[model samples]
Target chain A: MELIIDRLTKQYKNKIAVDRISLTLNKGVYGLLGANGSGKTTLMRMLCGVLKPTSGEVKFNGIDVSQEEYRDSLGYLPQDFGYYPEFTAYEFLLYMASLKGLAKQSAKDKAKELLELVSLSDSAKKKIKTYSGGMKQRLGIAQAILNNPKILILDEPTAGLDPKERVRFRNLISQLGTDRIILLSTHIVSDIENIAGMILIMKDGQIVHKGGLDEIIKAIDGRVFECTVDAGEAGKLISMHTITNFRQENDKTFLRLICDKSPCENAISVKATLEDLYLYYFKEVNTDEKLF
Target chain B: MDNNIKRKLKSVFEAPMPAKKDDFLNQLDYPKASRLDFIKSQAGYIRKQVWVLSLLLFIGTLILMYYFEVSDSVIWILSSALPFISLVSIGEIFRSITYNMDELEMSCKHNFLEISLIRFGILGLANLAVLISLLILLAGKTDFGFFRLGLYLTTPYLLNCYGSIFAVNRLKNREIVYVCGVVTASVSILNALFTTQINDIYTDKYWSFWIISFIILAVFSYKEILKLIKKMEELKWSLSLTV
Candidate 1:
């Protein structure tokens, strides 16, 4: 199935949260990369019909996002989600399944199967209040796919996951990507660097870059430079350009900087990674801490 | 060997394994629930403590009625307390909204309003059932007749329901429900205190006034309920977009 987002825009009283953005998606995984408050949540919320656009609309295979039919084919996991603390893992999934319109027996079976899939079968009977942050995130992921939706939207799905759990989630998402349109929004570069077929980079409520991973990386080709200089010179270079990484080795400092031209003497050009491109665009914003 | 034979015989008698074990996976049609099924499932999420408290209150009132000389003052006092049972339910309706689950539920197939309305109806029915039981118990025990019993029981309950529903619809904040609930309940209690005499309600003059007032509150509540449902539907899309 194909999903079309047409000129979607959301404006608050004074500031626009999501500028006019239009794109089409199909059966593949597309990673949405942006800093916090860059409108990723707003865009995803509009796609799921949770937030209405000011001037444009979203449709999936000719079905409007506001329609019940569109919602039937859609699954979404918001950045900040809440659960009934009293509900067991199994009960929460079953309740969500019922909301998604699953029959009673089908909901029961699916909840059981998903609990096992998320490796929470051992805690299926435990209350959600007893779950860890990572386990709750896994439960969120399970519920998003409960309907086997044609379009899945996950906002910061891996926020609380450890490295091992992150890899496991990535593999599960990659597996599910082959049959449905999955749009995953995350500030973590490594989470999507290997799995996403395409990356959409947002900055200041606008999509600054959208294409294949290599194609988008090509935007920063020859602009990323690595150099070793004196600590004083390194500090000077850090102020002159966007420094993505810095390390002190003995009396010398090694730095990875993004610049249009070489910022220091004997600076060596390096291959541009997704993180380099991210820092290049969101220069004033600090996204390095969010990296895996 | 005997256990194996028995197992084999039982397997043969069973219904052919119901096709492949993964057949249910293929049978996964878009999950659609009827209204009855939806209400039943929604009812599962209602706080169990509310029911326990309602039952406790009922038992406590029954004990009082059995031990003391039941009067209109007692019935009036008991009716004023019923709205507290409904306060728990109104709180449940806004739990998801207050806790940041509104966006998630809004994106679901059944949507937020459908779920809220179902929970509201469940509590409404429960409150109704409790009212009827109390009416039956107090009808024969006291000099208060059917009209007085019905009017006394319904007034506070309807006032609370209408006020809570109205506040939830008009206000963006979920906390207003508690404020509205307190105001409604307090008013009901104060009114009950002032109208304690059975002779006051038994007269033709005040009986017609109470009946007319009941009709007006009932009509206003019905209209406000429709408005609340419509407001909830509109709010699903608009609430998050606003600042």
Candidate 2:
């Protein structure tokens, strides 16, 4: 199966939320990496057919997203959503199942199966408002997959999960991604590094980079350096380089940074990671078309 | 690994499940939920209180009709109270937006547009049933035709619904129910004023005016319903305005 996003654009009165962009997705997990206000949520909303675009279209196979036929095979989890306060997790899933057009018996069976799949069967009868943020998120995932959708779009799915819950979510996503066109967007660099097969970097409403991890990491390969220096020298290096991470132990400060070359005499070149690349682009103020 | 666990794992892997992808997917039957099934489901989503209040009002109308032999007062009482049946429904039906669940609902196979139309359709049919029921109860007491009685009862209901829906679409937040209540109260009071102060406004002397007003209000209410549908479809605009 294939999902094609063709020149999708959403413009507000004063600003363009999502620029004219296009993508062709096959059955794999795609990670959209962008900072807040970078149009990741806006693009996902368009693909889900919840928001009308100023221009362009999204289609699965040949079916346009605006058509009910397209939505029949689609699922989405928005960055923020809430449930009716009175609905239990079970009731909520059944409601979503009906919305997805499942028959009554089928809706019941699917809701039961999904509660187990998401490790929420024990809490199935509990009101949604009583669940933890992670539990609520898992319920959201369960509802999205009630119809066994072919195209799954999750916006910041792991935004507020604890470490254990994040790992569970990642494994769940990895498992679900094997047979669906799953596109998940997040600013959490490691979430993509761990779970996504393809990475798309968005900046200022445009896709600045798209590639596999190895290819994307090449931009900072051998250019990442680390060193332990006195506080005074550490401050200087921090100001001069794009430091992805830094810590001070005793009087010496340790720095992991991205640069064209080692900025210190004693600094050694280290392997670059996605976090470094993410920091170099987002945290650093270089306005170049390509990373140095 | 423990020997027992290792053996169990090996056994499970050796007996790996069959693909059955198409067979299992066929069991889902995602597209089978017909429009009628979806419409049937919407009635339950409307708040319990709305249904209770509507039933209570209908009963109250029945008891009140026993005392008033005058067709004008019967029509006045039924029209003022029944529009609330429409007023509270508009508030409760669109509570998905107030609860922030509309976005999630909009992405579903049925989507928001179909859901809104179905919900409004179901409630509208119920409101019509109540109007007709009241008319049947008072049919023998009135000198006017059944058609004219229907016009009088429907006009005020339409007026109240038009005002509340207009207010609900224009406003935001959970307090929308209160706004609708104000609309219902205002329409009821104005209907009361017309009943007592105008003397012959609800009498046979003004059946023609009632007919004209009913026609105009029904058109305006229908137009307002169309506007509500259009606004519900443009949910993003309203959502962004709130943000």
lDDT of 2 by residue, A17-107 (tens): 7898988999899999987778888888889888888899998999998899988898899888988888999999989988899888889
Which whole-number lDDT from 0 to 100 does residue A141 have in model 2?
A: 87
Residues B1-243, candidate 1: write the lDDT tens digits.
699999998888865556654445544575567868887878878888979878987897788887888876676677678778878777787788666677789889998878888888788888778888888878888666766888977776777777776676677764565676676677677667656744566456677777777788788888898987877765543554333
The C-alpha stretches of model 1 lying farther than 4 A from their native spots are: A286-292, B1-33, B140-144, B174-181, B196-216, B236-243
Deviating ranges (above 4 Å) for candidate 2: A284-292, B1-31, B67-74, B172-175, B234-243
Candidate 1 CAPRI classification by DockQ: medium
Contacts from the true interface found in each model, as a fraction, amount to 0.73, 0.79
Backbone clashes, each candidate: 1, 0
Q: Write the per-residue lDDT of candidate 2 for residues B1-243, one digit (tens) a residue.
A: 899999999988787577977557645545467767877777777778877887897788778776656556666777777777887778667777767788888999998778777777777777777767777877767786688777777788888977887886677666677888898999999998887789887677887888888888878888888887888777654345222
Residue clash pairs of candidate 2: none
